[model samples]
Target: MQNDFWQKMWASGVVGFHQPEVNAYLKAHWHKLLTTDHKAMAGEVLVPLSGKSLDMLWLKEQGHDILAVELSLKALEEFIEENHLHRRFSIQDLVHERFCGYELEAMRLFCGDFFHLTREDCQDVVAVYDRAALVALPPEMRADYAKHLLEILPPDTPMLLIALDYDQSLRNGPPFAVSEQEIHTLYGEHYQIEKVQEDKFERKGVETVESTYLLNFREN
Candidate 1:
């Protein structure tokens, strides 16, 4: 999907992919990959390509500061507005619009392009939760995304990445199809990659064929 296509989707309120509830895969599997007897996340989490999902609320309840990066102000607006949140707005260098205290304990939201968020913007992230980031971009931009993420997050940070794969000819995508090889190619330099889960799914509502992958990118 191109920039104009996504910009139009936001402009026209066409975010059908935005789920109202926390992702079940995230709920069930995220902690498994993030925390074990050996190690656990120590500080705030960075959620890239986050579009005001209820996952932020859930994460906050677990005592994690939610640092979310989003592209559309409309998506952020819908997230807070639809939740009937009394959000306080402000402008910061990275935050185009911010919804203060939405989930308690500084759920800082940056409503702008993820690429524009600098390394300084992600200073305290001990964990990176990518429920929706990599596969959201076109094939060419994947490397840049991985590089920027590793540059920002502290080394040895645990990362939970959820990706979708399938034949693109089967459907048009905003949730673009990305394969396991591509995942390794983009992120292998800075992270030890592993495939934690996979599933075949029917996209009955949307015109798409999809399979999901749960990936662990242990920062090297």
Candidate 2:
């Protein structure tokens, strides 16, 4: 894994990818995967590769338990401190020696590698909110990540996976290009897949790198 890229991104505070507002797509479309037969359903959700973002709070507000996994301890610490949350947990003794969960208690953020944390650790996730998990990794790692998640998920669990589809050469990525076929290739065998959303994007700001693609998966 290219650990340096993410470590440097956090170290340098280059968090342009961290959206301040709750993701609209997440708000609107996450339920589609959670509901049974399109009827509104409520259950715990897992956010793999979650950074210090407010989306977990938003999920809690909607009455669902949220489990977010991240690799950076610094990012997780800042998230709890900035929110002024007053809860803390110790998992290092039980798991990663220093990895912990929520400081306020609504969510759990594992401050360690996602690969190291088993899917059994996130067992309650009836639905997965993969807003940025797959796209964050390089190609080789993405395949393993997807398979590992699917294997650990409860049978028949559904997932909402978001992937970017655009020319990789057009823009280098951490928001990497994960084409529709790749999503299918990675997850289609174990889940019922569909296109939940797709949008087109043209490059915008000078520093703003860009690409476009969207896909969701429902485990059968």
Which one wins on lDDT?
Answer: 2
TM-score of 1: 0.82
lDDT of 2 by residue, 85-122 (tens): 54443322114454565433446677667766665676
On TM-score, the candidate that comes out on top is 2
Please give, for residues 171-211, the per-residue lDDT of candidate 1 as tens digits: 77657888778877877665667666677766744333233
Cα lDDT, all candidates: 0.68, 0.69
lDDT of 1 at 36: 41
C-alpha TM-scores of all predictions: 0.82, 0.83
